[model samples]
Target chain A: MNFSDIEILFVEDSMDDATLTIRALKKGGLANKLHHVKDGAEALDFLYCKGVYTGRSINDHLKVILLDLKMPKVSGMEVLEKVKSDPLFKSIPVVILTSSKEDPDIKRCYELGANSYIVKPVDSDNFFQAIKDLSFYWMISNQPPHHL
Target chain B: MKRILENFIPFLFVMLSAFLIAVFFLVLSNIKTLDETKNLVEETYTIINLNEDVLIDVISIESSIRGFLLVDSDSFLKPYENSIKNIESKLLLLKMVTEDRDTDGKADELQRLIILRIADTKNSIINHKQNNLTIEQKIKITLEGKKLSDKIKNVIQEINSRQLALLAQRKHDNIDSDTNLKLIVGVLILVILFLILVGFAILKIQQQKNKLTDELKKSNNLFSTLFEHNPACISLVRISDHKIIKVNNSFVDLLGYSSADEIIGKSENDLNLIVETSDVEAIAKLIQENQIVKNYEMQVRTKNGTLIWTSASIIMMEVENIPCVVSVSMDINAIKKSEEKLLAVNRELEAFSYSVSHDLRAPLRAIGGYATILIEDYKDVIDADGNGFLKSMLQSSKTMGNLIDDLLAFSRLGRSEMVVSEIDMNSLVKTVVFEQLKNDAEKIDIQILNLPSAIGQPTLIKQVWVNLISNAVKYSQHKPNQKIEISSFQKNGQTVYFIKDNGVGFDMQYYNKLFGVFQRLHSKEEFEGTGIGLAIVQKVISRHNGTVWAESKINEGSTFYFSLPKIKIKTK
Candidate 1:
């Protein structure tokens, strides 16, 4: 597979949440040319094309990055900070998709230049619908910066 | 010192009066002595005059007797008789004037001489008239008369000399008394002047004392007014005895006593005022260390035996040279009760949010996800009945999810801090209405009228507008026109924003359940809702210190009204 064709970067820790999100995206016809990372460190590795992702092309750009707050190592806020601080990745849209809407980190994410915030619904149908809508809005409808 | 001065003043005055009275008596005695001297001098002069008259009468009798013996005539006899009569009377007057024993002796000898002279003259005259007297007999009578006259002269001289001596002594006494009186009067004048000076000094001292007393009274009045009218309970307690020396009206009222008299002069322990004696001991220890006890909360027992909460600030103060603890306390029972209630509500809310977030959502997600997987992955094996049941189960879980989200949002509305700003209601309502209508297929004729600006938390107020406008659109969807009007006006200093909807309105009798959480006026078949939207709307509007109400008639229309404070722009 060519890494330059990848357009969606999904970062999440829970296998169950990731499977459901990928399933929803696939159903919504947005799963093609996507990349998945288990934690913030792996997400960083994938973004900078470092460590296990060194074989990937550095010139490849992701259309959108979906971040989760709670994780096992190197939390999502640190990942957002690292990506948003770098000039190369700062223009890329960041969408926070998490289970908790009550987490105060939602405001911090927005303050750190997050493009959108969405709370995962407890019901599978609503959750799928929310992911489908987010994918359509961020990847299909929103206009990306020319540099990205 | 002042009391001693007050006592001495009257004593000094009394002594001064006594001295004045003594001087008056001395002046009166001196005057009496002068008067006695004057009377004695007058008596001496009269005695001398009487003595001289007696001498003249004796000389006249002697001269007339000799003339009668030589001329042997009646005229000489007449002079002799007249002389004898006048000499006797003059001798009596002399005796009366010389009433004193020393002068009376002289007067008696003078009288005997006059009588002898008169007898001798009568014998000579008889001898000459009878022609039986020889010249030698007449001459012998004349010699006897001369002897008597000489003796009278000696006695008269003696009486005059004694009167002269008496007059001289009296004159000396008068001079002495006059000098003594002058000295006494001079001393009296000096004493009177001294007394006047002392009286003036006493008056000045009395004026100063009166001024000081008035000043003391004014300060006492001020202190009493401040103490009695103070809003907080105040009391002064003596450190040594723990006796309540003074208590304000507020203190008496706080203790449920009739007056300050009921609390004053009684120790806190004696009156059973403090619920815990240990608290008093703690405060006393603090004051003894010269440390102030600030906001020391404790229980205090009222006169009616009810215990209430109090927050007291106590410090040691010097009052009238004695160290005392001045305590100022507030009756904080109401505040404490409200604080406890708030704490309990917060705990309940915490537990509620926890359950909503963790326990409720986890099971709900499992139910919905597992149902969806069963239907999707096991589609060929499952029958129509199983599929329908799974679909219903999925639908129910989705509804439950929405319900949970709404509940969480409602609860979060209370916990979230408000970010207040000036909100343009016109644009805010337009945005919410536009966003809400973006996904809906049905046409909503939203007439957003001229809406004024307001002061509120923008995000919360936006939620309120979203809820109201969406409710209007959902409830009024059945109408053919589906007309909804949004407008605002200033009412009684508040900006009232309203959404008027022509919908299948509910009965007015159920208005009480309109804004309650989870309260539904219509069944799910009629309208799909978690019934938490209006409750959230009410919560948000109320958090802004505004009101939410609805005016509706069944099938006629409904108007939802919410009022917020108008923003005031401060001008410099």
Candidate 2:
């Protein structure tokens, strides 16, 4: 995926989190064509090109799956597991975006094959820097599983 | 030797001596009757001796008459007749003597001798007339007469001599008897003297005994007075009846009465010493057996209508050779009150611990929530150092949350009421392991093994499994396979629960901190934790009256073990 298709897929439960996440991604210069979902369930549906995201092709361009752990329904861990387990979307990097550092589910995410895990910092600059670091790794350095 | 004695009550000795003396006097009276029968036989023998003397005199007279008849002169005949008359009178006198003395056989033998003499005289006269010329014949007759007369004389003398010898023997026996009687009198006198001396000595000894008894009575009275005055309750009871034989002034005072006289004859049951009559099963026991109920507590009713709790130690005894029970007493109301106060203090301590756990969580949540809000709302404008500073601030919030959680876990240990039951450790671990896996939508390979059912509170016990299993997953977050094997079984009367985790292990030196509140070996940035998971696990196990410990080395995975009491609970 090139910089044009490297728009962020932010999956978070908190509305405040999604807004702050978008702002942080934009500040890192990696926010073009930002797509958002409220929970892990929606993130899965969109990644599989089903539900509201039907007919969408994840093959041409998905940059990163930014997921949150604690949500109303499907947790970020569930999304991570579902997406990483599928041949169609396992190549796409999934980063956990959670409010709880002690989520206890973080290890499960890593075990489920999430590409990266990050804790949402309450401080603005730390939150921004973490976003920047993940975007740089996925878009530039992390050469996505060499296209089949 | 030390004299083994009881309290010598005098009646036992007096009654024993009285029986012995009555048997001795009865034997002495039987010996005196046997001496009187021998004296009557001697008096009858003396009367036979007098009869024998009269018979001898009659035979002499008969010989004289035969001599006179041989003279053949008229004048001589007249004289002889007179002599015969005299002899007859003498004979009559002998007969009278024989009758008086009861010797008739001796008198008849004398008459037969006289009659034979008369017949011989007549035959001699005839022979003289017929043989006119026989001088020699006459001479021979005379000689024969002389011989006959001599024979008669010898017979009378022999009879007298025999009678005299017998009389002398009787006299000798009497003299010998007199000597023997003297010896008997001396012995009897000695015996009587000894008896008099003994009786006098006994009287003196009895007087001394009486004096000593009086002194002992005085000492016993003084001792009893001491007991009465000694400022403590004392009582004496007669064993035969369940009645108070004696009650001291102290006891009388305690019962609020003026004198022991009022309390005498009253028993424990009558005075209500055993306030609840039904509780006197021990009283029945005391009655059935000889027992000393020592250091027992009981409520006794007083004369003033109040009950007092008394602690007493009772003893079994024989007073005046009769068994009785005595007891020493003390009051114990203060100790009871203090015990109740101690229970109240424990309850207050429990309440304080509960409040401490509840108060800790609110501030912690606010700190964590607000910190995240700050980071999310203003992340765009922060500089590099500002970013690091914000991260540290978030670290501080996380640390506080962990502290709060750890404190809650520690306090919960005190509040969780124990509900002991049998729990299957194997099935339980499988379920917990699967929950850990499924709850996260993770495929982290897990392992479990040999588990056993243990007696413990299931809900609290599940916490132990959850915490240990979650700890394995968290620490092994960076490891591949993420294998966790859980096996528990019973051994040595305890159900041991174990979890082995292949994770970034810890130093054995810091193993002590594994189950402590807020004890953490890894930094929060390396492994996300509240630091209270194992602590909660430790607390849970301990509430079941168990223990939690871990063995690990740096870089080697940790193995955690715990044990629960192997109590078997009934299903029904």
Best by lDDT: 1
Model 1 chain B is weakest, by summed lDDT over 10 consecutive residues, at B354-363
Give all candidates' CA lDDT scores. Answer: 0.83, 0.65
Positional deviation of B564 in candidate 1, in angstroms? Answer: 7.9
What lDDT tens digits, residue by residue, belong to model 1 across residues B320-438? 98889889999999999998899899878876675567557656776778789899999789999999999999999888878877888888899888989998888898788879888
The ten-residue window of minimal lDDT in model 1 chain A covers A139-148
Each candidate's chain B TM-score?
Answer: 0.51, 0.46
Candidate 2: Cα lDDT at B82:
51
Q: What lDDT tens digits, residue by residue, belong to model 2 across residues B404-495?
A: 54565566566656877778777887787778767553647666666767888888888878888888888887886677777777778887
Worst lDDT run of 10 residues, candidate 2 chain B, spans: B1-10
Fraction of true A-B contacts recovered by candidate 1: 0.48
For every model in order, what is the iRMS?
2.3, 7.3
Worst 10-residue lDDT window, candidate 2 chain A: A1-10
lDDT of 1: 0.83
